[model samples]
Target: MSKKKTAMPKITLIVLLSISAVLLILLGIWLVGELKDSFSDPADGTEPGAISTSVSGGDEVVMLVNSYIADMRKDKTLTIEADGVSVKLDLNEAGAPVDYDELESYMKSKGYDTALIGQYKTVLEAQGEPGSVYNDEYITKKIDELAVNVDTGSDTEYELIEGGVTFYRGSERTVFDKAALADSVKAALDAHRYDTITVSTTKEAPEIPDLDELYTMIYCEPADAYYDVDENKNTIVVDHVVGYDIDIELIRKELTEGTWTEKTFMKQEILPEVTAETLPQKYFKDLLGQQITYYNTAEKNRTVNVGLATAAVNENIILPGQTFSFNRVVGERTAQKGYLPATVFQNGGMQEGLGGGICQVTSTIYAAALKAELDQVSRYVHAYKVSYIDLGMDATVYWGSLDYVFRNNTEEPIKIVSSAKNGTLTISIYGKETRPANRTIKFRSVVLETYMQEMKFEEDLTLAPGAEKKIRSGMPGYKVELYKQIYVDGVLQNEVKINTSKYSAYNGLTKVGPKPVVTDPPVTEPPVTEPPVTTPPETDSPVASGTTGEDVPVVETTSAPDPNSPGI
Candidate 1:
């Protein structure tokens, strides 16, 4: 304390104030690591200390982030889109685009981790350019990975949808036929190998030239058929006349399907639409204005099983999404197929069977297909009313639950010819021969509402009250209502909804009796004791308890009503 005076020596002012306060605390720790490397990685665009890049900086900062990811992937392309379809990241070839500002100039000269090496510098920015990568990892490299980018199409322009079915027709010569032939739209390929960079659609479909022997056996030879864009529906076959015969058996049993479409294809041309100048006023007014008839009381022997009103036809034509089937061409009516019995509807009434009364031949071909408006493909509903037709405009079939189907769906092709003996069933659906006769349907029956008859009790018979029989009267049930009235040439045009026929309520079976057939208490004869007459007491000696040698009248037996026993 007393001699510490040497302390005043002050070795050069304390070594220049301790080296200037250790260089001001190492320049404030190098200015706080240069402001923490400019805020760690303000998106790694470099500029801070100019060196220590955080990806732990190794391989010379992986060679300056692989030379700015090779000028940011040289010929880039990118593109990308969603829902409405679009895609193009063509990573190579003349395909490029993902430079995004040279990925921020190589995430700022990669002091290594511009986000863990920016996923190896976005595949060195998807390689078409940027190099110095180890030795071509698929022509480029650098690992440090982390992936999950979906939205496919990085390989090149993409497209994939595939669903279709279209059929168009609006002719005098084309309106929108559309499918010239990208293989006419039937794609189902899967050759695989990543679509080998996609490119396989040469497209073709030619064969459709027989236009009835290529234009009537080369008649003028100039009868063209050309169809380019490769050819399928772009169909350009110029012309071919007369080709008819419809009734597609429900289109060969619903859609000319397969097992190889079961035999059916043929083309014709005989009078296409009856042109020899309209075939004599179509036989003087559709064959003398058909008078409609079919009266065949089962040819004498009677009993139903007839195809009687054989085959007859004045005409028939249909064309518009066209299709009308009925066992193809009404082919099964037999007497060995000659067809001739008449009258039908068996079982629940008018008994006869083997096509009895052919539904009066399907109700006279359904009131000539509803006076030629024709189109009722599979009808059925005739439990009773079979006086030819009429009744919600009659249409019946039992084969497949009612069927009279129809379809001109219409623009042309229609013609049906029919005719049958003594009485009638004339059908004449001809078409396009000046196109007149506007329409005339008329059925009109009106309020035929009559129900209440589900009694189904079978036999509760106890008859004879007023003794006046006939409870199920004449079995002539009648509750009819038919309305379709649509006349355009004769005026009155408008009345639709045509279907309401139910005549199944006929209850009349007279002969009613006196009621109470069995109330349980009626056989009273149990007290007739003729058996104890002095009893057999004096039996032996007298032996005649009221004279009994042969008078065995003990009368005491009656017990027959107990069917299963239980009656209060």
Candidate 2:
């Protein structure tokens, strides 16, 4: 039984070995077949990444594609029609056709099929490009051909207009649509790439200007130069002006030819009528009149008032035919104006008041005007005679009530200059002398009548027995006639009666003791020693101090004749 079992085991082992060999053989064959399929050479033996277009079809197909594209690119010229205007584009130059390599690439990418031709046709229809190309240099050259020489109507620059533009292109005298032409030109340029074509414009231009407005702008009125006096600077400033006029025809032609610019007008300069060289320098040169008056400088307030008025009148100019007003020129005299109260003729007697001495200024100016032969516009005489001026020559001025006015009737202007010094008031008028030099003028006064003032006495209780004192002094009155005597070569030519004056008398009074009183001999008081008086330097006139002391004199006198006194 053991031997039989052992033999069975051996047989099983052999069967297993046989099955293993068959599986080994099949695995080898299958592996060899896979290797053969993996390493085999491709059809036509071309390298990788290489393009091959060889096919069963002949070169006719490739040639057909090339010819079709070329024909489409170079078949005929492109025509741009807008508003009946036609423009042609040329495409025969180099780099003007489609690129062959580019076309091949497009065809390959899309693949060969019956629809490929239809695809090309679709591109043509969509693009609407006759040349189907873009050549910048060629297109610019063609554009140059359309340029036209246009007259700019300017001598300075010669300009030309570009682009083929016509008011009537196809139809006879038809209104062309400029907007459509511009739009079509731009579209054609964008849609097609031409080899040599250029678009330009040319048309008649019109320019018009408002002649009236131009005239207003170019014309200028001639002005006269004049002097402007700066009072503060004490200088005469000259104002200069210039005038201009335009050439009308030159500007008109320039505007019509569309060449008018800012520099186109021709201007003419006009000189000023008055120039600095011809300006007046001196209005008054010669001395025409002069006069002097006397004043009591001891009256300090009166002297100061006179000085103020004189200063106001000094350096005053009166133009030809201009009137001089004393009140207006002197202004109002008040305490604010530096005036003090002094003796003035009021109600036929001397009264103390403000601006009492200003009348002296008016009197002095009046006499000076008379000597100069100035026209007297208005004058007022005082009711009573004054000690400072002649009876007929004195002129009194009051604010708002009275005024002294005189006019410069001479052909030349006149100026007034005044000064008060050494108890004398002098007024001089300067102007071009028109009167004859040989003629001399002087004033003459004739006393018509004289009357003495009545004296009266008054009782005084303050004085001792039988003692008397003069309270007021009396002055004599007189009526006088003034005349102006004109002489030529010391021979009297004419004597005309000018004015008549009447002076009123002033009353005088004396204070006297009313009754004598009996009294015993009084004891004698010690003698008081008085200060020694020094003798003053001898002068022709007696000068009194301005103090109102009891010893001061009422009237001051000078050795020189009192020019302001009556009948001077």
Tens digit per residue, CA lDDT, model 1, 203-270? 22222222333234322212222112112211122342443333333323323233221233332324
Model 1 scores a C-alpha lDDT of 0.42
- Per-residue CA lDDT of model 2 for 124-239, tens digit only, reads 44446343445556544433333212122322321111211111111112233344543444455454444332233343433244566656766777776553434432224366
The local lDDT score (0 to 100) that residue 365 gets in candidate 2 is 90
lDDT of each: 0.42, 0.63
Q: Each model's TM-score?
A: 0.21, 0.48
Candidate 2 regions with alpha-carbon error over 4 angstroms: 1-280, 517-568
Model 1 regions lying over 4 Å from their true place: 1-349, 371-383, 386-392, 395-414, 417-430, 433-445, 448-476, 479-484, 487-505, 508-568
Residue 555 of model 2, lDDT score: 27
CA shift at 39, candidate 1, in angstroms? 99
In candidate 1, position 138 carries an lDDT of 20
Error of 1 at 274 (Å): 9.8
